[model samples]
Target: MRMRPLGRTGLEVSELCLGTMTFGTQTPPEDAHAQMERARKAGVNFLDTAEMYPVNPVRAETVGRSEEIIGDWFAKTGRRGEWIVATKHSGEGLKAVRDGAPISSKTIPETVEGSLRRLRTDVIDLYQFHWPNRGSYMFRQNWRYDPSGQDRAETIAHMEDALEALERQVEKGNIRFFGLSNESAWGTCQWLRLAEERGRPRVQTIQNEYSLLCRLYDTDLAELSANEDVHLLPFSPLGAGFLTGKYQGGAVPEGSRMSLNAGMGGRKSPRVFEAVAAYLEIASRFGLDPVQMALAWAARRPFVASAIFGATTLAQLEHALGAAEVTLSDELLEAIDEAHRDHPMPY
Candidate 1:
């Protein structure tokens, strides 16, 4: 529950951000409220959600339900100012929202307004574009990613247009800062360049997947984050609960994510289980909870602003909260590095 600065925004956020992707779907409204209260009690002041949320099976009908649940909590507790809330505008290919509209000048205002209405908040602490309109290498796309079809000038124009709209949001007090998700180093650089040149809101954070199983950000993006002060808000630090050792030995517990989505969003693989076993062994040897080890490892990274984690139940949330106290020793970190070397990119 340690607080950290969110990029250069001067807004401090908890080291662990409570994720609400399951708030209204797998998790009921009352449970979601209890989770929020529990997290607040644990000193977590940051929450992350999106317009297209409650996503075990993201549905058009359930769209924005997670934010609505959070809004209800805010209304009931009257504690909106106690936390820094971050949410995303769905990008292209999310058919449930705006008919799969790409984020652009026209979409920014309405999307921000919609999120505000659902969250019962006036100004968003961090408004993130869920992904680039052109596309991204995240979500297992790196295996077949190709950028040859991209139009550089067109992409730059889109960035400029989106930044302009975001600047207007800043002026009108709709959003205080802007961020990106599922973006690449080059894409982030362009956003930073445009903001510097135009004096728009700086890209404060990059909320990408980073964990023991996913080290995609350890190279260029890590350097970019360190040098530019655009810290990372790593989502899925537990590898979608795979790192929690729940999916081991092919045991698909009922009501689990793997039970709902058999593939776990392409994360289930022979190599992945091997990687999980290796990390789990390390945790067992060190007498640590695997969930806390994985989350603490992600939070300990130099470029991480916060590690975003989701829990489907209060017990799961309490388990993750223990990570705040589980500090990895230098020897344990080295063991994790050794395991990574042995099983890199398991998924």
Candidate 2:
């Protein structure tokens, strides 16, 4: 796996990050460990997880179980510092986390302490806020998103408060660098401006959904990333299993994400299948595995620091890792461009 620099921190991360949100829920502990070992062998030195993980069926009791799994892995392997460990603090709206409250000045320190205990580490390499407290367009909220009533001054105050809390975490040695997720370019600029004004550490990376099907980060976020040196840690780079051609004939394929949430969180639609098929056909024409094409496309994006991906089983993990070596050619990319032009905003 190739390594990429994470912003201006001088920290090198793997091009493909091993995502562990499936750890305690869809996957058993042993299998999770096995997948970690496989990823390590493959030279992937970055691991990403979050506090409210194992999220397919997020439950109050199993909220922090994913971190516990990682802690166990570190304890058993005794190689805690061999790789870069990145995790996030859950923002408001998730019922099981912090009583479903938003992140604030009072919450950061305690959240850092809890994450440290569960991760079996004294420090986190990259600490990220799962989303903004004042809310932004993400998780398919774009459909009904309206920023007309938002108070810019109040939002900046919250951003500054959050930055102060993050700065405190940095001073306490709990978190080295901070990141943003599900954020817009304007929101990112607000955080950077606040940090610079206060002489605090600016946000470094962004974790947003970017895939063949979802190009939300392409225009504005791409500019922000390239210009500000903010890196992209794209999650669900496969379009939540749609780009893999698994749901082509309307088959949910037992135990897939579709089996649990049939709507795939509003991602499933009439146009989505045609878009998936078009990309699949291009991959086949180029003699490429659709999964490989999907992953490679995300990884090769100019501003992408790393693509975050997860697998439910060992076989699935192996299939995803295989994409690490495939490189998309100009012909394949042109075909994909044509497909995109023919069908934009499928969902």
Candidate 3:
């Protein structure tokens, strides 16, 4: 596995990040530990989870269980320092956590404290906002997304205050760096601008959905990443298992994500299957496993820091790790671009 710089933080992370949102939910603690072990053995040094995780359903009862599972693994194996752990503070609209409170200066310290306790770590390597408090266009919210309700002055004030709070965490050695998720290009620029003006921690990365079926990050976010050195940690590079051809024929495998979340986190549109079929056909034409094909494609993007992926079974993870060695030829790249043009924005 190749290691890349995590922005300007002086931290090097694996090109592939293991996502633990499935831990303690569809996956048990023992299995979760085994998965981490397998990922570590495969040279994946980055592990990502959130406070409100184990999130196929994301119930209040299971919130924070994923981090706890990882923490237990750290205790059992004494390998906590071996991995660069990343976790998130839940934004507004998650009623199961913080009573749907938005992340702000008032909540940053307490949120960091809870994550530190659950993770059994003195310092979180990368602490991120799970989503923007103002709202975001990710997760298929783009079609109906509206920015008219935002108050510019209030938003800037919240960002400045939050930066101060994050600075405090850095001073106390509670967090090494800060990041964002489900954020837009404009919001990212604002955060960067404020950080420069106030000498605070800059947003190092943005975790957003990027896949053959969802190319939302290929345009504006792509430019920001190139110029600002804020790279992308793209989740769902497999299109939530769609690119694997498992759900191509309307076949929802018994334990798949679609079976659990029904909507597959806003990726279950009618046109999505068709898009998956196109990518699957490309993989088939090149004699490649669709899973690795999709992952490798995302990993090769110019602005990607790491490609975050989740798997319910060990076999799935092992298969995904094979992407590290499978390089796409120039022909395959052209074919993928053609496919994207044929079927853009499935959801």
The top-ranked prediction according to TM-score is 1
Pull out the clashing pairs in model 2.
none
Task: State TM-scores per candidate.
Answer: 0.99, 0.98, 0.98
Which has the better lDDT: candidate 2, or candidate 3? 3
Candidate lDDT scores, in order, read 0.95, 0.90, 0.92
lDDT (tens digit, per residue) of candidate 3 on 212-262: 988999999999999999999999888888888888767889988889778
Please identify model 1 stretches exceeding 4 Å from their true place. Answer: none
Per-residue accuracy of model 1 over 11-126 as CA lDDT, tens digit each = 99889999999999899999999999999999999999999998989999999999999999999989999989999999998998889989999999999999999999998999
As a whole number from 0 to 100, the lDDT of residue 268 in candidate 2 is 93
Candidate 1 worst ten-residue window by lDDT: 241-250
Ranking by lDDT: 1, 3, 2
Itemize residue pairs with steric clashes in candidate 1: none
